[model samples]
Target: MDSYYFDEKSKFDARDPLGILYKITFRLIQIKVIKMALIFTFFVHLIMNCLHFFEILSTFDADLLVKYGPTLFPLVYGLATIIFDLMFEKKTAIVLEETFSQMWSLDSTGSKTAKKIKKESKILIGLVVIDTILATVAIMFYLPIMEWDIDIYYAIRLFEMKFSPTMSLVFSILYYATIPVLFFSMLCTTFALFYIMSYEKFQTYAINDLLKNISIDYQKIDDWKMMRDQSYQNTMYKRLTICIQRHQLLKRMEVNINQIIFTPI
Candidate 1:
């Protein structure tokens, strides 16, 4: 009885449940990141639209400013989130799983394709840095803008400019409170993105190893088959040779017996 599990081939390490959970959590985070990114983008767009409606941001090429403020940031965030998900969650995950199974084999010839994917991490990292900087700048400007007393600045103050100090204080407090939550949400998104990108490296390595493993397994099977065929052929040849030699000897014996019986008498 073979105790080894031939059918399953590889057994995942039982001690790595935490790691597995972590990976799964990261994937879920990816999903949430996209959702939150869209939500934040919508909020920004709404703010921009409101500013435009109030003519607060209408002085400088209204169309272009609106396009940039309300449209561009959201567009960029949504697109980046989508692209990241496509790469990590969809393509990279499949490739990694397959690669993992392959690498589980002891023998492998490694692939370079995965290496190419890993080399793009620099680009991903660069994007992350740029986005972070942009987000920071946006938030910095947004905070002052939201808090500013436009009535005082423009002096065209509407009569009903009942800027409630209490409301302002309340909003300020709420903003501070939500800032942490927002930061946490963004942190989760960032971490998720980083993990996915990082896992890409692992995936590439795993895949290359898997290719090697499959190659080795196939070669081994082919070699065994060739040896088996040669062995069968050798056995058959030897048996045929013995049969032929025995037949020849029997014929010779029959001839001798006939010759003896026909003696010159």
Candidate 2:
């Protein structure tokens, strides 16, 4: 609601970075049912991932671990992040909502800053897409077809699921579907961390400019007792207050990142 968000003022009303992710996160905070559903689905995916992890350990194949470790851990980290968010639902929502609102470009439409934001959005999205493509290719071609299981056999046995090749394939695909889901989840929360930190540099620049302008404007005043000088002083005081507030917010967000993000789930 403050002047911090250019999207609130932009011609389009909001041309959000990672627009899909922003809407989903924002809505998750507003809607209790959606939040609960998200938590349940994330928990289910985590259970599936754990089952596969158990399957890996069951094999006791060091070579298999070496082979699958890279792919498997991304799933683990991704789903773990989502599950952790469910665990700390309120704090997670606070951090995510703040991130969506604050890390976004404060530049309005058609400016160089806006264009730069667009390029950056594309690059980050491109990285996620490329990773997904490579992982898909590896799963389809390099990963042994026999090895790619969402522990489908275990599910069929446990549920007494109907058995047929078609059904089996369908079940396999459904369970393994967690890969993209988890990946996208990570993109929204965990993987976007670096992108968020990059915005801190902009914050630092803003702070510097604010301080410099305040100093310049204060010095420009000819008579401190005059009404004009008093008005100028009030304006500088407001800018200083905003600068201090932003600095403190950045510190809190940093601590949140260290605790919630760096420590891992």
Candidate 3:
């Protein structure tokens, strides 16, 4: 923990601004509401992907496969990739907390927030373009597999299939459409993933920077180890300390205000 954080004046006092801030932060974490919500959503996405995968395998219909398979395969694979990548839950949480803090600390002046938002927005747009291209390529790879179905299904819709050339042309034209939508959906998801990866990088970078800034001699290996351990402890300890301060502040404020009102001049 930073010595400043525990200093007598800096120490969270019931009367201090930091004390109230800590309390609010603690309440948010205590309920574990955000954590629960994230877990619930992640599972829901996984279940939906599984359902899509099953639906594709269950149906032999070309139309159904063409309509659904493209999205379903990627959906399952993408969610699986994200889930696996997020195995480090503790580190991911730290990233989210850091992201939240960064956003919360942003100054509206000089378009700082705006610039950040714009940059993120561009990344999102790029993500959409990339995922769409990927899914579209996937669709094309599956097209050859659909050739046999056309022979059988064409007979049933022969008159409609008579427009086969037109349909083919149209399908080619609209092929790009499916991907853009998929791309956008995937892009939104990437934001969360990006934050997770980014936060871990930030933590590692901060630690490395700290080590470099300390012009320590080679004999001070223990000091370096202590610095690293201290950094990790500070992350957890600060949050807990904030919680404690919040509770203390609330109790102290009530008592102090009551004493002042009751005491003689």
Candidate 4:
């Protein structure tokens, strides 16, 4: 890897405090909170669904199970995908962080193309923030209607079973709380994965462009080197070799990203 691509300080450093906060918030939401929510919600949903399953079994009501099964199926599949993504999230995060860092460091050369890469990076980051907020808001609005219109019906059915009033209230409370978390976590996981993939794709495109620029520079150096001293030509050749190596490294990174990150999606 190029030393320029590996610089840690360039990863999330921003000029404005808000930009810094956005980076912090993005990491927290994507890497930490989202995982925590997924695990928490998964178990909670499992417990709640088990309770419902038992209720159906006890009642021997095949129709009830049939009614709720379709609705529950998608949530189950979505959460499973979220769990699968969590398994490889650490590796994906490392690749994504390096890609993000390289975008910023590319601008350190002070070239117009580098500046353009940096600008596009900032725009992508902004889109991530917006996507997260929009997903959150949509979940908030959608969950209440879902719970009231659908979940409450199932809860009412489950409540009819013989049980103490206190236990009934407890089940109701748990059911309401877990349902929203389950839905919200699924949405967040989807958006976070999307943001990571989008960043990877953008970085790959920028790196390709950088490699093209480097190739042009190498050609210019070759044209100039014919008139130069032997030692100067040797130095230019070494630099050209480094550029070729950097291009190959970036191509490998893209392939690794697709295999490790995009494959899970």
Indicate which candidate wins on TM-score: 4
Query: For model 4, how does the per-residue alpha-carbon lDDT over 1-265 read when each residue is reduced to its tens digit?
Result: 2222322244434432124333443455466656676677677666656777787889898877777776567656656755655665556557656644544344333255455656765776677668668767755653435534354346544654655778866766665565566655455456555555544454455455544544343354565655565865665466556455545655665786679755656
Q: What is the per-residue lDDT of model 1 for residues 1-265, given as tens digits with 9 covering 90 to 100?
A: 1121122244333222124333543455457655565455445434434554466445555554444454335433543443344333444444434433422221111434333444554455566668667776755543435544332222112212444666655644443333333433454446454544454344334443443343232344565675668665564455445334433433443354335324423
lDDT of 2: 0.53
Q: Each candidate: what lDDT?
A: 0.42, 0.53, 0.41, 0.55
Each model's Cα RMSD: 24.6, 6.8, 17.1, 5.9
> What TM-score goes with each of the models?
0.37, 0.57, 0.29, 0.61
Which regions of candidate 3 are displaced past 4 Å?
Answer: 1-72, 75-179, 215-265
* Rank ordering of all candidates by TM-score, starting from the highest: 4, 2, 1, 3
Candidate 1 weakest ten by summed lDDT: 151-160
lDDT of 3 by residue, 9-65 (tens): 222123221222223222232345444543444565455455545645786556755
Q: Show pairs that collide, candidate 2.
A: none
Per-residue lDDT, model 4, residue 81, is 55
How well does candidate 1 score on lDDT at residue 42?
A: 42
Per-residue error (Å), model 2, residue 106: 1.7
- Ranking of all predicted structures according to lDDT, beginning with the best and ending with the worst: 4, 2, 1, 3
